[model samples]
Target: MTMTFAKRSGLSVLALAVALTGTASTASAERNLFDILFGNRANRQRVAEPPRQQPATTPAPRVAAPKISAPSFHDYRPEAPVKVDFAAIAAALDEEDREGGAAPSPFLEALAGLAGFDLRAEKEVAAALVTHYERNPGFIWVEGAGLNDKADAVLRVLNDASAFGLLEGDYAVNVPLAASAVLDTPEERRQALIRFEMALSARALRYARDAHLGRVDPNKLSGYHDFPKKPLEAAAVLEVLARTKKPAAYLQSLHPQNTLYAALRRELKALRASAEKEIVVDTETFVRPGSSHPEFPKILQIIERDADAAFRAEHGEVLVAHAGSETYAQELVPVVKAAQDLHDLNPDGIIGRRTVGALAGESKQARIDKVLLALERLRWHPSHLGNRRVMINAASFTATYLEDDREKLSMRAVVGKPSNQTSFFHDEIEYVEFNPYWGVPRSILVNEQLPRLRRDPGYLDRAGYEVTDSRGRRVSSASVDWNRYGANIPFSVRQPPGPANALGELKIMFPNKHSIYMHDTPAKELFSRDTRAYSHGCVRLQDPRAMAAAVLGTSVDEIGREIGKGRNARRDAPQKIPVYVGYFTAWPEAGEVTYHADTYGRDDNLKKALAKVEEIRVPGS
Candidate 1:
């Protein structure tokens, strides 16, 4: 009853079917063919049809995996045994080992053993071995051994070489046996050692250069390597290493107490002090003749006239005239004499140019320079200053006793002549001599005493001097012919130990190269003057007995007890006291400032030397 479409063929079947299909399609379109057929076929049996089913699902297609490429063996070849000149290499290696080779490596060690060098368990040899292999990589191919084994052996040799200091340089590797033997003379050994050391140092430096990829300046290396001796050569190498590897550490390693640092530190302190604002002079005025009154008519007229006048008529910053009364004159005479004594001028009561210059503050800069020089000198002071101390200010002509920064006492003193200046340094107060003898210095004996002795052979005898033989036995002064004994006197003259001796009452001994010390002088009148330079170079104290007591920490009676024992009584005072003989021309005093003449002219020379030194530049950029 249902219509169905069939597959069409290519030509003829298509034409026949086309005609029949058209007719059948038209008839079926108008009629209910299924109903008609069903009615007619009711009597006939109904044809049965089976139910339809769906087709089965298929899985997706599989993809093939990617392939990996193999490693290339294009240049592969079996490693050949390294062709080592075992004999020559061994000898060279042994020599280097003996001298101390470079950083050790296994190849170097093996090479060393081949040379019969038994450097057992030396770490330097091991380091040398590693270093050798690193530098000479071709040593890796020794046929029968593993790479590490060969390396170990090579390292052993290199380390051994290093232990011998051979790794430092070629000179180490080629040291002659004879050179190692101790020479009869130090000079010979020193020279030989220096030569060998320089060679080793040069090699080490060259290696460093290569490692750093640095420009090897032969001249610079030579300069560094050219040391005075082996120790110096070693030091130079260490210095280079320090500079390159650890600059700060190197600097720290150096002694900070060097002279240069000390000088710099002193200069800094002085500069700091100079920046302070403080008036140098206070309560200073000039006395005029006939002036018990506050002002003199003539001096007041001069100052007032100047104060009134402008440019050209300026005058009277401070009154400057003459001494007023006989009392004033007497006082002024001593002050003037003091000034004269200090400056080596005539001790007349006349205020001349030199004295005027000193009082006018014209020498301030010169005085400051002296203080600076003193500060510089202190840089070389001994490591410690004792708890109790004595400081002699030679320029100011004063001695101050200090116990732990507190002033115990002070005394007027007479210092050296302007020409024979007192030396600056610290010494210990070892002993005190009561009734000390005066053994005159050679300079005084030759220049001053000899002339007097020539004038009269009995001059010394009259002066209470005793001639003595070399053995200290007293001899008669009459035995010597004064005319012939001008400079040829073979004997010595000494003042006997007593209160009347030039070293009066007591002498404080702080032995030094100058053979100078502080002692009581019968010349106490000298200190009353403003300037005292009566001694040749020794310091003469006004109240030396008091000074001795303070220094010894004992009463006067106790000191007497010690002195009575005589025989150069040695007392280790309760404490060791430092006695410093220093020179400072200008220093702060109370509210004002005091200055001293540059009695010795050392300031000028020292200033010039300082200037020259400041201009010098150290080496090594």
Candidate 2:
């Protein structure tokens, strides 16, 4: 991550890039600086390279170039012979190894052996690389005419690592390779170039593994997740790169494939634009119904960073401040919501903590951190979510049914309350329960209903709740001494299926230990509120009929007709649809984005976790 911008005294771009491999960053690609080294306008005095962004999805086929072999110099030695010190090189690598970093001394030793150890074990190894050609007069992988193109492609991928939430620092060999122009001695330079080339190969493999498999395991933390990434083999990765025509694009394709990840990347581009615009506001601070604040101009300026921003597209007026008050006095709730929508917030006109946190309306650094955290969470998802599936964002309190990456239906969703949060997990909807019974969870009884039972046993009786023993035998609530039992209520309760039942008319079932499911809610009014965390962990669907129709492969009328029968019934879904219950605070839908509340505070949890592990270390992923 090029976040460390401190000049390296005598060192230039190459050394700076080399120093960054140990850190993380949110830095953007630098085109102007890159141009001086490898752009089309680069000096042809050195090997010319073209740094261009390539489509990362499917790489175009490459036209193979003729190989250029290095000439042998074994027959006659030079007048001024260069001393090769294998021992000194080994000692230098060992010194770095003891210090504890990314120094793979064993591998470095093997690599040094191939180079004949014409190496300088000095602190200024990057600067010393310029003298590599003066020591030796041959080359390996760095001799072909196609070298410049391959080198340029790798450099472009390194600069654009932010697009995939990976750090540029992880793949920073570009600078050294590009600055190879300064190395005049062909022999030593060829040997040194191979070192950088090998380093790139090592870094690329690590980057690809991280991009494909993700860094952290969600299940390792306190969440419902079963990681599905397969182990990566170095030989397999090398084979792919060997055949890859456009190496940069091929490597780039190894990120989250869903559209949401791409959309977040698009939004990140906007963050860099409004970095200087800070607009901190209270949770209650919002665009007044009748008047707009002077800060309204500032808001417009920040929101206008994206020329095609939804707010700007909807309102193309040149908003200006008044002469005296220096404020724009007009309705701006729509604008606020538009901006919030673009950043994956709840899209409420209210400028709450979640909204401010997303808009970078606080500190620029905070905004950067928030965006970076979002990208990390994206990495924790299934590599390929089913082509046809149901996705419910617990944070957004919304559910979407999609087939072939296109949405068929979407509706407001009521997730769990703060105390009883909906977990992050995924499963297939194998069956549906119509007119379902509400077998209340024990936690709910201990924390919520037990107090009522303690106060008055008549409460359970009046609520029409049926109590039973652990053996499934029906029992009366009045039989137990409320004082005897603490928070552990060793009884089961079920509300009969009907209008008053919490299951409403339907409940979609999936296999999970959390006992969470999707179902219709009698309290439909909860979905209208800006904050919809009103359930006891299970998701309460706003329009269950539509969801049922989509999942069961039928029409809404057919689903309603079945539900209208009044009697209890169960049916298996013809084709089981996978359901993903994810927690994305910032998500992209269509060309815009939606920001939702961090209802469970999971975002904060993830941010802290990312802060600790600077890179990937998922257990057995």
Candidate 3:
């Protein structure tokens, strides 16, 4: 409890007490007040009274109370000059505590036992629980020997964890038996209450952390994954659990608040509610409009199941005609085209790989995996991706510029191949360089160029690459001993700014440790493909001038004019724009969920990692 002091007669009672009575007790009261408002002042006490150090050291492990501001007395007034007796107020507080009595509290005892509770999560979680109960020891779930309404609410939320792409068992707990049923002894009742209290706290805290910061540490999943940890204060979770009347709503609110996550949730719900059995179509080659296939009946059945009722009725004759036909007749083209359009395909009625993938629509289990993986990965990034951002979705092979959560511009982008996979991270765009020099990375230098250099020492020179020695001196490529280096090279190789340069005209630089950024590529033909994964690691933009203009806060003409006068020139962006190089197999686009092929097999990797993490979170379950 805190006491607020108001000023009287141009000085506070504390100050007046100090002035009137120069006793240590009065000074101690003032010091205690300061400590309560700010933090512990043990250092001041140690300096004032060295003999009291022994007693002060005993309370060292107790967590400090949160600092609160002192109440202001700006409008305070008194009808008449009144005297405030600080001692009387202090005595009254003490009397109130004495009246309440220091009876043994079973709840407090149970909370104390949490120090030894085996919370099977991270060490930080246990530490957080300690800090939480140390600050304010109280029960948020159980009441007496039985569960309360708040406990019921939390249990309901935990049971529905599957809807949020989480396992219910992770936060599951057996409800304590009713007082009339099994608690035949006082000790048993107390033990039941203790288990109920500690288990609720552990599960609630775990759910809070998993819903907010995600369950799996992305860094542990794979070498390609990189994400900074988001802090989850356990004390704050306890505060919410103790205060909020609507525990169910609060638990639901822990999910990622974004359009993509919401869409995925809807997709998950729809998929699970769907009663249609999955149909597996087997095909060896492209099934064109007029080409015959053994599985044409299965394909038509899939279209009929997914298409609208009106379409099904209209195409009922054709469907019956091709119910078991092995030939793909011309009459069934419209039906196949309609299904293709619905699945976001080119509507060419050509059952190519993408069309086949769409027709099959991934097994129900596979779709669920994609949605669950997407939800977990979405939690790795910020909920609000700022008003201005360039998001590159590697799975979709596209980059979109968004402002105020609305797509401002979108363009095709070529990402890294599976062997040289692009990383998943976010950074700010700092500058854009025109006629940029391509300083070859060490991976390309050693793994690619070194062998070529070993065979033809003058290869780099013929390719118009400038070579430098270890001391940054310009050297001929033929002068270096390429055989000496195996995995790494001390010398650097770079290409001067030219039309034939790999990085093309301009490169948007974020300058991260991965050396990945959005750049213009001379290989424009790669962007025309359905799946554009060809770069070593950097994102290659199809329209570099438009991206430059967007980041620089200029027009395409202005960007072109700057590029025309470019002699390896660089221009800083007016302001930093955030860029997210992300990978999502299932994502929201144009108010609908669009599922893409798991390009780097990240979905499988993440799914395996999630299973492994769950095994650790709940050993047997």
Candidate 4:
């Protein structure tokens, strides 16, 4: 019995390798297993492989090749968005062409079946027809044999998703569309039309969502942040695409729905293009305002690349030399100050860890990874952001109040230190407490108060921290064997409202499982630094009263009057303002993009996750 062989698995294996590594090339005039395993993708050429020699005696028992799974849409696509209303889609399809050319009936009939359907492509096709008609009274996008002008337009956008780090092939645009574009039968044409529209719809929506929200999950990065996964507003995007004459321009608008995202994206692209040599961070040598380093010229070049009119006006074109050597320009004072404030630095116009990191800059790849991760974070938020909300950027260590998209108040905040970094989550600021007591977290009691208690038997008493058993009875720290408990102190610790209380005078409540809240701190001086990750896990607001005024919808004087009463009380807000504790390493505020040191190293962790995810997804030799 003769057994014939199928094509070698080597070619497909090579293809799979290319897809995974995203590089294709030709081998250097040689054939090897490494070349086969790793696609010879150096000069965008594939090396021809030699046939495998048969075994000396028994022809390796005619084995059928192992089945390699073909790539599919589900392989790379994000979570299917929550269902949306295609209610108006049929109406758009029923729409008449005031223009002499009638809308394609086959396409229209295909669309009627899609009413209340979740197929994004049908809606896209319908919207395009309506938009084209609305713009030109007698125009039709899908005409005779194959895809017309609009189909080409849709495919173009679908093809470009790769520029935004998305895979166009995953959309399967090339295969089905090409097959349909050449078919003669009307039935085949109809099927092709539907498939084409659907592919573009899925592709466009995927691109928009990935661009605006991001491709990865923030919670996956650090389990601390509870970022809600919001569905992409794909219908709205389809509408926008249909309405715009410049389809490419409309697609470009799909990135970073917010300012920080746009800023980060631009920086990422620019950094990747930047050719500045990496600087070795000299932790020992501090670059004071007047001090100069051998790398100053290169640093100045980088600054000049992004300096705007305000930055330039504030800093002269040249830095006057000082001490018979190079001096830090006085002009860059505002530059450093702005950078420090935006990055949660001391804002003292000095080069510290935060400042030095910014000055030294990151590897281009590193910044690109950061920007990509930041983009992913944008997707983790709800589909809607209230016109007025509180933004507590845990990364920047600042709380900002926005009314009608305008920044009203921005104050320094002390987030959880590196050991116990702040959690990134969102909730409503429903109420505020004046002269609030500090309900110390168990982690704090275990890691902090317990150690201090061991050192000083009366430390809790001196600090005014009250102890209570889990059963609600008062407990004396002196009675417990501190050595036995160590870090796991079983008792509760509370600091009563007073001048010495850790919670200071007020607390902002947004309840979560973590039992973390924002409150005032007696250590107000800590906010003076650019880096203020001081607390265990809770956030410390630099100015709670100011935040109170913003949240309560009251004047600062009114808050002052309420506090003057000396009554410890909680007040409910007329409307619960939304609060977001987001971690962003590179934030865009004011005018320029300000880079921050990743205090939690969340960026690095996220990069690792991305690689791990890819590895799990792609099969290997």
The TM-score of predicted model 2 comes to 0.64
* TM-scores of the models, in the order given: 0.47, 0.64, 0.76, 0.63
Ranking by lDDT: 3, 2, 4, 1
Q: In terms of TM-score, which candidate is stronger, 3 or 4?
A: 3
Candidate 3 weakest ten by summed lDDT: 72-81
Per residue, candidate 3 scores C-alpha lDDT tens digits across 3-104 of 333442566657644654464487566754554455322222222211111223233332222222211112211112112222332244345446768864
> On residues 1-621, what C-alpha lDDT tens digit does candidate 4 reach at each position?
001111343345445445544666534222232444443222123132222223235322322222222111112222323333334544544555333366555655455434434443323334543454333332123455455666567667767654454545534453344443466666566555554554455566556655665656565554575666665566567667656666666666665456555566677667767787665555443567777876455455545555667766665444222222345677666666765564445677766555667656666666666666666676577645678898887778888888876788888888987777778788988898988877787666665566666555445543445667678766555554454564445678776666666787788898887777888888888887767898887889888889989999998898878767766889998898998888887666656555566888777766665565444322210
Greater-lDDT candidate between 1 and 4: 4
lDDT of 4: 0.61
Error of 2 at 471 (Å): 2.3
* Maximum-TM-score candidate: 3
Off by over 4 Å in 2: 1-152, 174-198, 224-235, 242-247, 270-371, 482-490, 615-621
lDDT scores for all predictions? 0.48, 0.62, 0.73, 0.61
Model 2, residue 598: what's the lDDT?
Answer: 64
C-alpha root-mean-square deviation, each candidate: 53.7, 27.5, 28.4, 25.3
C-alpha lDDT of candidate 3 relative to the true structure: 0.73
Please identify model 1 stretches exceeding 4 Å from their true place.
1-368, 486-488, 560-575, 586-595, 618-621
Candidate 3: Cα lDDT at 351: 77
With candidate 3 superimposed using the best TM-score fit, by how many Å does residue 467's alpha carbon deviate from the native? Answer: 1.5
Q: What C-alpha root-mean-square deviation, in Å, does candidate 3 show against the real structure?
A: 28.4
